[model samples]
Target: MSEATGWPFWVMVVAFIAIGMGTSCMYLGAVATCAKNYGKGKHKGIMLAVPIAAFGLSGMWQSQLGTYVLYERKVDGSRGDVDVFRYFLFLGILLFVIGVIGTFALRIVDDEEEEYIDRTVEDLERSGLLEESEFFRPRHEIQAAYGTFNADAEEGSVTLSEEERQQRKRDLEREEEERRKKNWLLNYETRIFLQDPTMWWLAAGFFLVTGPGESFINNLGTVIPTLTPRSYAAAAPPAGLPSTHVTTIALTSTIARLLTGTLSDFFAPVETHLFPPIPEDRRRARLEAEQANRPTLSRMVFLLPSALILSCGYLLLSTPLPLIDPPLLHLTTALVGFGYGGAFSLTPIIISVVWGTENFATNWGIVAMMPALGAALWGVIYSTAYQRAVNSGSGFADGQCHGWSCYGLWAVTSTISVWIAVGVWLAAWRGWKKRGIVV
Candidate 1:
């Protein structure tokens, strides 16, 4: 293997990155649903726990498999500081084939299935339930809101059991007929989520995420000590708790994700429940009665609490914890965890509303790239700053400056976070404006 094929180190990373990203996406979808379902008061927390807990436990298998493959390469002498085109080429081709097969094998909802689901839900609602059952669909169909609702309702019945069955069938037929008369696809509300608000916004967001991720993804592990550093030789957590580094990284991230996942569920209804026009039938009545209420901005009203928490977290995290003992440090880390978690939870809903989910997969995928870029940026920020400060030649090397890695990373992270916060507030304001709900 030559430089043309590049470092085997990089090849391995790319492969693992694909694996990591795919894993992350799987996790994101699962965890976010926990939030969505939980927020909507539909499902229990078990759905979210199954993935994280299972992943945490089963992680060893994937880890071992990954390690085994790498070790085999080493033993076979393919693991020099050089490249093995043959190895990577084979791996790449295998992955590509697997990808192709998996790609088309997936069946998104066809028109008929969607129509059937819509009608079923509408029937359930119109028969005086006053609302669709939150868990209308089973687990499998819940992804796209398609599934069965094994339910029936009625008052007391006289004799005539056979006639009652026939009559019930007739009632279902009547509901279907009524639903068919309404072509919901033409209904704008149904289509809102699918729309990508702005091409430039999505594109910018992607690069924003990717630039930092690519540039500095692994830097934090060195300074912050979290999860498994790409470099495994460092150390594992103590039996009592993971290593400081592992705990720092994993605890924050794990807690952040857990809390954020749930919080997003809490806020999702707000994101999707937008009937900006107040519905045509209710517009006049709402407007006439609305004059008495105090006018306020949506961003200020809706996001204020989360924003304040985020601000306090930001202000405090930069300062050292007055930890006489170890417990305070962990508690401080948890507070940081809350800030990070809240932002992660809220940002998606903001994006979903700002852009719509029409092309949301792509939209989110792009925006998601920003954190990567941010990480990358922080990596560069740390590495360069640390080197420069050490060489500044002012004899200013102090113990406080001994570990500037976290500080450097945080400097860049906090700066970017400020911008992200602004973007979030702007999104909320804009979302309300679009709906005529707030300024």
Candidate 2:
């Protein structure tokens, strides 16, 4: 490519990284906004699922499009693709256009405060305070309680003395403090969330489950050689294409995400009742406390089926495939995809359940880092194991790997690791059941 077209390799690397960062930042902000605004609604899971499913499915779309755009047939009937640069350029332009359109089209207007205000107003009226003329008087408790929305305040502007202005500022500050107190469970000191053992346990579970799934997806191209005939392994797209595997995985993942997220809503009624209820007298005091951090629980048990599926996927992969025809490798990939997508879809809801949504963006960011950590660690394990297997076998010189021997150890390790993650999740679930905390 460099000989034919004066393109530097380093420039492509730089452009790729820069574009990736920009796109990731856009999605992060957009997804966080969606979570914060609609995190509590009936269709909350589906709303969150759409963005994640798009991200999971994009890999297949990009792979197919790039293959179509870059493929070229030579006179000798071998591959002669030289349009790699063009393929990336097309993808970049498409992303830019979509990002621009989405930026203008999407918005999140949070009206959560309005719900809080209505509740407070109803409480005041029920207590017979609203009927008192003194409640509307200047410097009254109700006036201060409502702050800027004080209905008794004059419509016309009026100048105020320095002392009066200071008093008004104090009242506004007091109002904010009261609101925070009322919604205490929705707020937490970062230190408290950090100190919680459950957060780390969840991260550990993420580290375990996500590592194997990521490793499977990332190593699909390499593993395909062992699962198919030699000629097919060496062939490009439209012939002996391994992209079918990629497409299958992506399709299953997208479907799983949409289905699981939507179905979780149906179980919400049964699942929410499992939590311990607040005492009548303690409810108001709890809400009014400085640190009203509660042990949050969720319908995370809904994810058990997905986790079991992942276990089965890894078990299949761990089995030797010398007779590839006997067992379909694509089925394993699809199972992994389904499990991965379900886990990804459920994590946000779980986070919102375990940790209050008041600081969701920050909490999710912390929780999300576990996957990357897992990926880095397990990627090395899988790749290193495969390389060792290849080196021990007779095909090292020609760069040809044979049979399930290549990934057997990697698969075994991954299978065990995923089940361990399942155990950890179960422990957390039991904790939630007993104490309303994920522990």
Summarize candidate 1's per-residue lDDT along 1-439 as a digit string, tens digits: 6556546787778878887687666545554444334422322223343445444333333333333343344576653322345445655666567557645643333334345345534543554442443333343443222112212333234344767855775666546544543433223334443352433443343343324333322443333332222333333311112233234433454554455445434433323233222244455565455544534223234333443444454344344432112233344344444444344444454454444333334445555556666666656666666566556541132311223343445545653655465465555456456765422
Write down the RMSD of all candidates, one decimal each. Answer: 13.4, 8.6
Q: Whole-model Cα lDDT per candidate?
A: 0.42, 0.67
Which regions of candidate 1 fall more than 4 Å away from where they truly are? 1-7, 28-113, 116-221, 224-242, 248-278, 282-317, 320-332, 349-360, 393-416, 419-427, 430-434, 437-439
Clashes of each: 26, 0
Q: Which stretches of candidate 2 lie over 4 Å from their true place?
A: 1-16, 73-82, 113-189, 229-233, 236-240, 270-298, 437-439
lDDT tens string, model 2, 1-439? 4656766899979987788677776666666777767765666777777888888888788777666656676899765654676777787788888889888866667657456444544554565545662323355654456655533342332566657766876677567655654444233224556776666777777778888888888877777666655554356421135567778778998998888778765444322211123333554454345134433224566576777888788888777643355236777888989988888788776766555444666777787777767888888987777777778882544685666777788788888887888888777677665654431
Q: What's model 2's overall lDDT?
A: 0.67
Which candidate has the top score in TM-score?
Answer: 2
